[model samples]
Target chain A: HLDLHHYLLLSTESSNIRIYYCFRNIMKELQENFKKLLKTERVPVFLTSSGTGAMEASIVNFFKPEEDVLIVVGGKFGERFFKIAKRFGLNPICYEIEWGDYPKVEKIEKYLKENKNIKGVFIQICETSTGTFYPYKEIGEVCKKYDALLIADGITAVGVYNIEFDRSNIDILITGSQKALMTPPGVSAIIWNEKAHKRLGVNKRYKYYFDLEQEYKNQKEKFQTAYTPSVNLYAALNEALKVINKIGIEKIEKNTSIMSKATLKAFEEINLKPLSKNPAIGVSAICLPDSIDGNKLIKFIRENFNMYIAGGQGHLKGKIFRLCHFGYIDIFDTLNQISAVEFALNNLGYNFDLGKATKKAIEVISQYKGA
Target chain B: HLDLHHYLLLSTESSNIRIYYCFRNIMKELQENFKKLLKTERVPVFLTSSGTGAMEASIVNFFKPEEDVLIVVGGKFGERFFKIAKRFGLNPICYEIEWGDYPKVEKIEKYLKENKNIKGVFIQICETSTGTFYPYKEIGEVCKKYDALLIADGITAVGVYNIEFDRSNIDILITGSQKALMTPPGVSAIIWNEKAHKRLGVNKRYKYYFDLEQEYKNQKEKFQTAYTPSVNLYAALNEALKVINKIGIEKIEKNTSIMSKATLKAFEEINLKPLSKNPAIGVSAICLPDSIDGNKLIKFIRENFNMYIAGGQGHLKGKIFRLCHFGYIDIFDTLNQISAVEFALNNLGYNFDLGKATKKAIEVISQYKGA
Candidate 1:
């Protein structure tokens, strides 16, 4: 599944002039693919670098320097929004939440009611650090009621979970190439509604590379980027999107949810508890027992089984670990991941039944009938 | 020569982790190839977007907001420095030169002596619009004597012309992928000395995407970009650089010089004159006669011969035309270009000797024995 044969074939013929001539067509097709996947016609998508760059673009384009904004920080990725906002000189009022806990919509509404001058509300749909999924639909309603734009960082949530951009009233939605898009990292796509566009028109930031207005004008008029873009990356992304469109995003989302549930069920068989109170579909964060070190278990799994899993970040480091079931993954991958965890835990002298996790994972996998 | 067979082969096994593991070695090899081509040990190259983005990086990294700088405007690209500086809120002292004329070093030195507050001197080595090659070595010396950074926009000058970075004392040198580097357009590279790095360290620009400090640290520590880079473009650029390194920059420069002279001789035989007082090697800008329309002539050549050539920009619109002989081009390309121009001009009611331009071009081509 990680093979780049088709991507290589597409890139070999990518000359500047040839790429330029076909760029508009590729962009149109890519946008159509995103529209189908995102299920939105009111929001327009623009491609850029990674999610952080897109977040910076959303902040710089929608708000001027020193403008008041509200940032909801649930985890590391959510905290990134606060940093980017501060870097751009915005007055960000950070609403902090516990690492594994979801943000309460009532608290967000009360804050919005108190601070009536907030220009935008920045939050993540899925906090990748602790694998917690926020109540973005309800939060989007609060932003709408308060007349503030809602920028949703859906880097891990977009394709892994079903997101209705216009229905959720998301003003700006951002996603990256690596997570659920199933392509290699490097490119990100941003979708914004007309309200965000109108707010962007009043922004006076002196940006050149990440200028959304120039990008919009060029993409609208010439169907090209404001600057030279990576044709090879775009070609790869087009192929990845074709795969997603063929399999259907709904099926992919269903598969991810099934995989996440199966992994959690296997963890339960091994007596491992989940860290996230409101768990996301893409990843399941498990809290390591006091007897087992999270980092050592991750290293043992990679060294013994030749598989890599993510360790915890920030304050959760050495206490929690994350298992990803996102992007081009299936039942076999989930079963193998659960088996590796069982083997590593057993090797570390933790009291767990041999093959019990694998049996539970197999039972969960047998229930799913779709490919 | 344009086939990406090797590029495809290299990209077929490109997994994200694999690409990451091999990125440092690829960047090291690429830097070695560039070192061989540019013959410089003092200046280190860092890759980014297009030349324009690199130009923005050079400005934002070296100068703070409201800082004084000297901009030598000879053509369209030279004027870009003024606009970018102004956009960053820098007070750029514009030293305007005629479109087809080169900037005098003595005048620049006089300006530096009078101002004493200029932080850097920004100019293009080869002005693409007018085909003018400035005296960059003398300008570099003037900048050194005045203790100001000398930034040379060598987008069209790098491989087509012989430039010794250390010998010329250039603080910063910038180039693009679409020019003499022979790769597709998407990436630009900037090279600078310790002096420029020191200047960049003190800059307080609130930039994220184009942050040179972060890029430099990432490249130094992990041999990776701060953001996800287009690996396929880097693969293609590596291939292109290998070709350049094998041929030797001196021979490539000789070939371009031969091609430029051949094209000029052909134009002279057809009673056409070059626009620039000091013309560059890669392109030749010709001012059309009042009886002939430049745009119509260009369109005629493109339609009849299925070849594309660049038209004039800005004030030179409908007055001048340019023929490019850079990047993976040979003597045959020059001959074909001259033939197309001859054919187009003759079709446009300009009476000239039939096949006279071809004979002059062939005569010039015969003088060069090396590839």
Candidate 2:
């Protein structure tokens, strides 16, 4: 997602105020729609450029340096949370798990008990890196019991994978414009609980650029940002939010979960193993055969089939590729992606049945259930 | 000229990186052209989001905090240089002048003897606020005698007004994208003389985002920014820079000087007094009748005429209205602006003459000497 603040070279002046007006109107609409669809009124919204920017804002502003944080690490994103916290001089008691597995809440609780001055817990609702969803509701509860703010990275989970910020006791729920928001990568949102806001005031060294105090002041006054903002992207975001409000989050998440399950089942039937055993509620990751490099496969699919599937980032690069079924993607798009993968694998001498994968995905999409 | 770096929020990676790319591309193209045109082998280059950002990079990176700086203060921008230097904890010895008066290099030489720790001298090539162009060549020579770097804030002068950065022995030359460069307000550039670069190595304690060391590393490696950037703005900047290169700086400056003189002559012949008697090299600032409020007059033109002329900023507020004849404005635009001012003054029941200003402007435009 794009951070608008970094690019604005000029300090605030009343002259070019129309641009900032457009920026604020679009973001406010997104937050309004998010609250309405997700059925939450307790959301304290903070807008940022990327998923990481939102995550950093949550950690840096809400917690003091040298404070303890329980980072539930599974994929690259969770690990990033730990790194970001450490950069602020915070020692995170990391509850590590394999890429395919979700971290257990009991283990995290034990780690929190052992850690002193523990102020917050960082959790990923859906890890985009490994296609695994951590148990957010339970983790949120554990955090509340320990008097710690439960910060959830819901970049991929917010809309496609349903999350009720208030019901789950998720103190801070962060998301990006790209994944479930169905917009281009440029903006993000952070919804903090009241506890986190109070804690933010306790940490004073957060500075102005990432400073919560000034952002809060600016947002309160004009629904505007403290820095120069991306008015064009905000225009796109306003439209995207309207679409989200119309469909509602429950239906969107149900559709995404169904698409994900169908894709996973198709992979299983074709003898292709899903990367994560406890799959991400939104996207799917599957390991390619050793002969088929994920990078090359991704490149081939993107170049030949016009399908932009994501490859593993960091250490898992060239090993596993992801087929995301979130946001604006529907049953047709999912089938097309599966078909492309099957075609690419077959051409590379890795036998995979295209017909069966398509049939299975269709069946689940037609009979998808929502609660 | 907004110094973007001062206000930019760094945590937004995509926007930060996008700003970096946009700025880098602008800096690269400008430097490449300067090198090709000047026939230089290699040169040190820098990119910042605001003209102010580039100015800060030039000041803080090139000199230590304890160094003495000789500031030539004539207009608001010249005063800004003093304030910025003071922000970096630099002790400034100012050769102060009244608002419309030109900063005399002879006066600076007398002050140079009194300040012993002076490492550099800061002055604006064009005193944008007052429309007074300082004698940079003379000032550069004076700084050379005392072994002090001559830093030029070329924000309003670079393209519309020409300066031989190398030939004049100007140690630091800085500019912003919005003014004479014809780009939107998002990027700024700093091209340092050999002497300034040598001093950069010794300075530490600079903040992370504005740090020169990291920018140098990132620019050389990937043409990528060290942070998230605004790609859309970068695209806009690319288009802007293309226009600058096509016209060449000499042609741009020649046209601007012609307009400046024409506008000034028009003001004089019509009995309208200009802000500065020696006229700023690039822009022409004219004072409204004593009866007409400058801000209200500007507002009337903006609201009624749809013409956006700048009102006097800071202390000059309600004193003079500035018409930017720099970057993209042509003969017709100048004529229309004069007409609008006539209409506005007439509407306010203050002015008597209608076509006199236009005739005077045309006469000066035709007679001014240029290649």
Candidate 3:
């Protein structure tokens, strides 16, 4: 029910070359704009309905049935990719890590050295499961050395941390509409380099909607899609892109880095251990004291402050909680979250300095501003 | 670019249940508000993309590869269905009608009686390509007698005409966000009765994104979708529903009928032969004299007067021109269009009356009002 004017602004006239135009241009645009902002190389192009869609596209296009893939599982999103890969009939070799630690690149390199005919290597840039950021640069090199495609799910890192797609030579980089893009969840994108494209060219069709070749034809021909697109969502992404473009990508990365340090510093001041000793560059997953019930703590924060901080997913569930410092959020939002957590903890019969989190957040932000 | 407020005001909530609520409640209110509105049992549903998406879903779900279908071909949309049916491996029996004339139900019945194994019938309620509306009720009854599903493309008719889906026993009805809905082109709605549902349940897994089963699961839970949906488009649809609720579908239908007749009268007054004796209840298609060059005439009107009249599509291309008497256009818009056409024709070296079209338009509207 979007207005004609809204569409007229965001919509490129369906490619002028043909009458059918792109069918899913609106959905594609949302993912494309988000990826562009994240500095993802315009490779391995795919558009799907969910974050899982991106993961599925990567597996289906890259692997034949029963083909082997190495899933470096440091957190929830990593496990999700592994599940999705198995669903597509891939036999994944998972390298599991502790909730708060990155999957070791050495272990991955060792596996690749021994395994023959490896289909791909899967890893998450920032694992939402336990808030761990893997050593993407290192793992990317290892995957390259072994001649296996490095498939990175940059779902949580895309808009917040720097992801050098070309520099890292990432074969497949997947992301979604929500999280750092500041758009609502609905669309996902997968960017592939030349090698990935060549492989996809020879693959058989597994699904119609997630097919990259058709999506590419639709976009290149008319800046449209193969099916009806969600035009209103496209309009929202267009507006959000303007904001991101004006602020510049480097500035966004720097802001998130500053916010993450400040958040961690605040937790340190309160004597709470961060989930990961070497915390992810963007997110700070804090471990609530064992005496504290995380589910109750989460509910308390939501009810009292109307803030939605994510709980640990899957294996890390109830052990650690996450604080997102992503797109459209700044120092003020970070400060607010810190204060809300402090209030909830204090109300739940815990004694702590009321201004501890905010003070550290402001101090870190000031230091970063000076730098 | 659209003003952000305009975008906000024209949007709908993207959640599926929220959309269902908006649609059902708006239809309910429209019924109570309009004095002449019929209580159609087929309540409209909202989809996330173009009207074609809705039509495609209908075909993919209701018919298997071995089934036979009757395709009523008058213009592009009718022909489009034929193509889609073929793609799905259905042998579509073509019941051809001239671009501007409504297909004869008797002819269709004769074909149905002769052809065994026909499982479904596809018809365009308003042929957008040439502005003709088929006799849906008669065709529906014939299909009923033969126990075949009657699928109607009502993309251009839903908000403009009184479609009593219950009384007509139309099995599947498709409509779009644009056209008579006065919304941007993104979402489409496919409304089906019990028979069509059973048919869909038996269809093979042709697509994931377009899968009806997943959509049903998503729709039933949280009024969301199997994948990420267009949140902003949902918002826009929600807003449009409010406007429709106030106008009532009956008044909207009556208004379109009156406006349509007025335009038709204008054509007659100018000595232009009506393209169809039994014209569509919504739009007027005027066939130009061979000397006039309909395409050039349409161009002149669009360029000089900034009035966009559609040129004929497919076989009728460059031969006939059409004016929509659909949503968001009224007496003033009609008058302006007629005046523009008259001016363009005269300027293009054709002899025509200056005020005839506007006068006839007024008279027809007055007659409808008196009735």
Candidate 4:
């Protein structure tokens, strides 16, 4: 279902960086590549906005104001969609789940059965707040059974996980530039199929800026945006797409899985607890002991080794630290970071075996699979 | 009213590019510098979107459905505002002008005088479609007399022209990253003063992603956005701001004016007609001869010299080609491009004297004054 080959490289001046007009044409290629990257046959429209903007656009474009939709609220990102839906006047039915936990397909089906007015279902492939990867494929199947639209947020999941697009039955999939794409922030994409657009036109003229239909056609034929785009970001992403093509997305996903499992093994040795019941391949969120201040541990690692590890947000703040495993990093880098954190935690008054974590990480890395 | 000083540069990794956590903090500096660039003391909030998105945000944030707003429709960019205002359910009273002609100050004054319910007025400082520059200072003064909030779209004018922000009496100013900022496109900024926020509390949560007030506070105090920002775009803009700072803005404006005048003089000698009644310093849009296909002339110059000069968009298409005078390019590059076009036109079954245009350009460049 996924084709990782044939990534097109844009022609630059090669001497200096400048925004070219022909980049508009190259942008078409970007959309196509993103379609392939997302493993969808749908038309993927790129917006000069954040992933959150795409999240908002997906709702307003497909469902009118006051329409009822179902949202899976697991953590920060899932909650964002729920909030956006609510802000736009949609009656969002929240299917609540614990932080670092995923949705039950049967529960979603039960909700759909209970509410026949529900037009669409929204969920995240990986909840960034808790590093939890939901079974989006299962959810998609359930939504299809009820003839409801399934919209998936793959912002942190796309290039890191090779989700079978057709089997997943996702009518719409969203991702951003700064995550697994290895590009900068600002630009995000909404990939949607005929199944979604046929029922509802790509967009109406009401929300003029975020009119996905007009913009999709505009970029396709006009070779220009309805507005000026971030040409520089596209230029950088041109390079990133080439890199992704060379490494091959499946290989990248395989490595991400390997690295995530390795980090989990290392954490077991160092007594760091992974918070997620279904941990994602993109990042690992480890809950620290009540006595150990995660923020101080993070500060120690940054100051000593100049490496950054993110702290948890929302309710989990100061209680967990996240280690990233996707984009511009490899298994060795992960091992090195775990080694740094191990010593840093020790320096921060947390008693942990220093060298044992790295040893366990090596053992996991040696058992790696796939090309 | 306008002060252009103090640009903050961000710290980057010495080896390679990676989205850093501290980048969230550094993005605050990017917003502050944009305020300085726009010469507004008010809070400037950035959106990971294009100028058009900011335009829509400005309209929806301040005005509810059925509110009356004044729009100056002159060219493609101007019509865009009218269209956006119309699409967003605002009653837009258009003060229409011919393409390449600016708005009459008295006409806007009369519209405000008659329409007491007009809450805001929208105008372009330099309409990109026709390369026309309006006298925004005079327009702003007239809007103030009626207590109308003046929203100026300076996407193509802000970095190229030195406008007195406070003296202009403009309440809200919008600009984009691509134009004179010399950064790649995608990100845009909205610089607003207390006058604008006093009547309205910035933005309601309805448009959650573009809730300016919430973003303004989140970026100022929390050092993070409500959503993920295009951190890499901020990184590139950081370097561009440093470059602009070292060169100084007033000098850039003076040089831009000189280049625009020189371009005008060159076109006059080469039989190219200036399209705009009030041509901007940012670009020179030259009307082509009827006998010559302007598109073919542009194609010839591009193919032969590998240089780009943009042809007109919308109604002016195939009738005019634009000569850019802002960002990265110098006077010599302008003369070189002009010379290339002169020969390209002559070769394309047109009659003209050779080297005369470049000679005329040098005469104007020599007369440039101010540091």
Candidate with the greatest DockQ versus the true structure: 4
Per-residue lDDT tens digits for candidate 4, residues A1-371, read 11111010111121112245566656867766765665666666778888888898898789876778999999998889998888777889999999998899999999999999999999999998899999888888888899899999999898888865765788888888777877767777787767787755533535777787777788767756666676656655555666677787889998999899999889888788799999998989999989888788877877888777888988998899888888877887898888987887778777766789889999889977522
Tens digits of lDDT, candidate 2, A1-371: 43434233321221242343345665677557767756677544545345666777787678876788888888888888887787666778888888878988888788778764678889888888899988889887888888888889888887775676668788888877666665545466777767777886666643334556667667656677654344444445556667787887778877787788889988777887888978985779888778888777877887796557778877889988788777767778889988888877777778766578778777776776422
Best by lDDT: 1
Which sections of candidate 1 miss by over 4 Å?
A: A1-15, A42-48, A290-308, A314-320, A346-350, B1-15, B42-48, B290-306
DockQ of 1: 0.31
- Name the weakest run of 10 consecutive residues (lDDT summed) in model 2 chain A: A6-15
Instruction: Write candidate 3's Cα lDDT for B258-280 as tens digits.
Output: 78888888888988877765778
lDDT of 1 by residue, B165-234 (tens): 7777789999886678776555678888888888875655356667788887776667678766656556
**Highest TM-score: which candidate?**
4
- The predicted structure with the larger DockQ, 1 or 3, is 1
lDDT of each: 0.79, 0.69, 0.70, 0.78
The digit string of per-residue lDDT tens for model 2 on B1-371 reads: 34322222232222221233245565466456644432343453444345665666666677766777888888877777776677566677787888888877677887777776788888888888898888888888988898888898888877665565668678878776566655445455566666776786555643344456566566555555544433444544455555666777777777877777778777777677888867875678888777888878877988886677877866789878777777668877888888788777777777577778888787777676522
As for TM-score, the candidate ahead, 1 or 3, is 1
